[model samples]
Target: MILVEGIGPLATIQDLGRPGWFDSGVGVAGAADCGSLRLANRLVGNPEGAAAIEVLLGGLVLRALRHHTMAVTGAPAPATVDGMPVGAASLLELEAGQTLRLGLAETGLRSYVAVRGGIDVAPVLGSRSRDTMSGIGPEPLRPGDRLPIGPVPPAIPIVDVAPVATSTDEILTVRALLGPRDDWFTDATALFDGEWAVSTDIDRIGARLDRRSGPPLERRIRDELRTEGMALGSIQVPPSGQPVVFLADHPITGGYPVIGVVVDADVDAVAQARPGRIVRFRPAG
Candidate 1:
């Protein structure tokens, strides 16, 4: 069992996320860096789909009740066990009564902590993922809360820790494919080749970007269409002509015009981006 001594500004338990619930208006609220979270789980001998703590912006302090193995991955937070600095993506054997601490993330915006056997949170709708958007599972975790951990054999899978550092500069290049409603815009090329600035208004639902160049507001289509299945990286442009790149917590149905969909591979970048970051989109092919 793990007890939360200090709940960071943005910390929550997440797994691979509850998919197949979009029809019910539930967004799959999983780790922003799903790939890194899966790898951390595998490294700690836990099920890849198991729930882990998705630490946002860092500064989380917690304690474990039993001896366990753990791994911290994604976003390169200054994570450590029992006050001792530990490298991200590396495995550590922790003892009972040990405290885990993390500082502000230096590179990426989000980091993941994978316990030896994963957090044993009750599954809701077949997922332990806490969907803040739809309130699917338990409410966001807080300090003084005790979280359960599963038991596992000693054959913990060990992996070589290769730290990945993505560019945190103002301009981030993201690959995308033309979207479902691409034809709605008179010149789709303007949407692709243009440089967009990540607006101050950004969150789990979507990141609003200030487009430097695109179809003039005068030429925008104001017709609202029926709801449709939304993809993870859909780049929707509202009537204002400003592009809002949808992320993990985006709704299943949106009335705005979808100018493009960022390629699946580049979705993680969009998820890790903080406000004021610049996003440059290019064609996948």
Candidate 2:
């Protein structure tokens, strides 16, 4: 079995996510950088739905009680096992009782730690992810929280993790299809045609964009009409005309007018976005 001994900062159990629970008002709480998590799972030969650790900001320290294969992905952070400096996007063969420590993240906000058979956590609502919004499963990892790792499935495949190339481009393009309420923002064609800066107000709930020009929208949707379902990347604009792009932790229902929905492929980039980052919306059509 795998073991996590010394954990620091915000560490939480995550899997692919609690999908299909949106109808019941549950947010899909999973790895913020899901793409990286998937890769780490593939590296360790675990199924895509395997549970792992989602390290926020960064500062997680742990150890393996038994031999296991692990991988670290998402963001550039220095991780080490027993001070040997074994980290990055590669499969690691951790020996029994080896100490694993994750240092501060250098470039990104969240990182993922994937184990061979995934973390041994009971499923709630058909998933292994923790819903911080709903207080589902265990709460975020606190100091001295003894993490339980599942039994290692017999064999782990060998994987090669090449050094990841980081991007520094100012323009972050996200594919979007227009309108659940396109008519509301008729004057703001620039929402699709213009460049927007990632507002400093961005967070797990949503990422707001700095508006260049648009008339303030009236939150006209009646209370009766506010229970509409939301797709993952729906870009909703409230009375402020400031767009709050929904993230994994967003509520299932919202009162604002959704002007567009971001494309699936670019969702990971949206997940990794930091405040002050510049992003431009592109029409998928």
Q: Which candidate is the best by lDDT?
A: 1
Q: Pick the candidate with the highest TM-score.
A: 1
All candidates: CA RMSD in angstroms? 2.0, 2.7
Candidate 1 residue-wise lDDT, 128-235, digit = tens? 877767767766779989999887745558575755655647788999888688877777767656577778777767788886654442334457678677788898
Would you list the clashing residue pairs of candidate 2?
6-61
Provide TM-scores for the models.
0.92, 0.89
In the range 1-285, model 2's lDDT, one tens digit per residue, is 545555555678888787776657687877667888888888888886789888876778777777878889887679888898875888888888887788888766778888888888788887788776667866777765666777767656666674666787877889898887776654445676556777877655678888553444444443434557777788988767778888777778776778889887887788778777778888897
Give candidate 1's TM-score.
0.92
Question: For model 2, where is the 10-residue window of minimal lDDT?
Answer: 215-224
